[model samples]
Target: MKNSVKYAVTGALAGAANGFFGAGGGLFLVPLLAAWTKLEERKAFATSVAVILPLSAVSAIVYWFRGGLDFMTAWPYLIGGAIGGIIAGRVFQKVNMLWLRRVFGLLILYGGVRAVLLL
Candidate 1:
């Protein structure tokens, strides 16, 4: 029951962020879940990726139905993204977790700083 509530809340938050941010719900979900659930950063990141797929599919469907999706240009990007994602996933298996955490933390910080400065 508790697990279900946590996932429900996480899903809602992820969906909301995904709707507005044009990027990751991870930007919000990571720290929230980390702090709330005490998840290690890598575990949190993996969880975020798992959560993102369904939300992204729903969003993609909306765009496609609205005629906002362009397959001709999007197809190449999709192929490249899939290849890169696969390679990155493989590379992640080789990376040290401590170092990966530091890098991921730095990336989140950098993105936050960039957004604040740009905004």
Candidate 2:
């Protein structure tokens, strides 16, 4: 019951962040899932990806309906992102967890720094 509440709260927070930001829910989920569930780093990442897919689809639909999504301008990004995701998915299995964790930490750090500096 306690665990369920924790998961539900985290999931809600992740969904809200993704809905508001267009992306980034995985950032929230990764740490929470890893710590709360004691899931291995790789499994946490893979699980977060699975969880975010439906959240992203729903958010995209809402944005599209509200005239917030510009499909024409986003097509190029979508294509490149798809290619990048495919390559990363393949690479993820080969990468060591230590290196992967380091990279993830760097990215989160960079994002945090960038967000603060941009303001």
Candidate 3:
């Protein structure tokens, strides 16, 4: 398939996942980008973040329109997330990709376990 097609498919899947899950586009995007587009690990990670930002914003807007969002409750996390994002963006280049991948895997494992247990 052409690169445009590959990217469109990937974006569609990521957007679906993000819209349905309220988040997690990056979880799908990172691996898909690495596998389908043959992007390097670090580049895939960065690209996923870029893509997710818009996906998340769109999701949030939809949720807000549906009265599903509570900005009062979300404000604290938004403030903290902004600070965290800034720090992560600054330090991202310094982190080793292998360790980053391992950490990402562990977080996914942890989330999966928690989700299963909750169910």
| Top candidate, metric TM-score | 3
Alpha-carbon lDDT of model 3: 0.92
Expressed as tens digits, the lDDT of each residue in 7-72 for candidate 2 is 998899889989988778888899999999999889999999889989998998999999999889
1-119 in candidate 3: lDDT tens per residue?
59889889889889998999877888889998999889998999999999999998999999999999999999999999999999998999999998999999999899889999995
Count clashing residue pairs in model 3: 0
TM-score, one value per model: 0.76, 0.90, 0.92
Model 1 agreement with the true structure over 3-116: per-residue lDDT tens digits? 778867877888887766646688767777787788987788778887787888887778789888787988898899899989988897688988877887798789889989
How many clashes does each candidate structure show, in the order listed?
A: 0, 0, 0
Off by more than 4 A, model 3: none
Per-residue lDDT, model 3, residue 64, is 97
Error of 3 at 84 (Å): 0.5
Q: lDDT for model 1, on a 0 to 1 scale?
A: 0.80
lDDT, candidate 1, at 1: 89
Query: What lDDT does each candidate get?
Result: 0.80, 0.90, 0.92
Of the two candidates 1 and 3, the one with more favorable TM-score, higher being better, is 3
Candidate no. 2 TM-score:
0.90
For model 2, the superposed segments whose C-alpha errors exceed 4 Å read: none
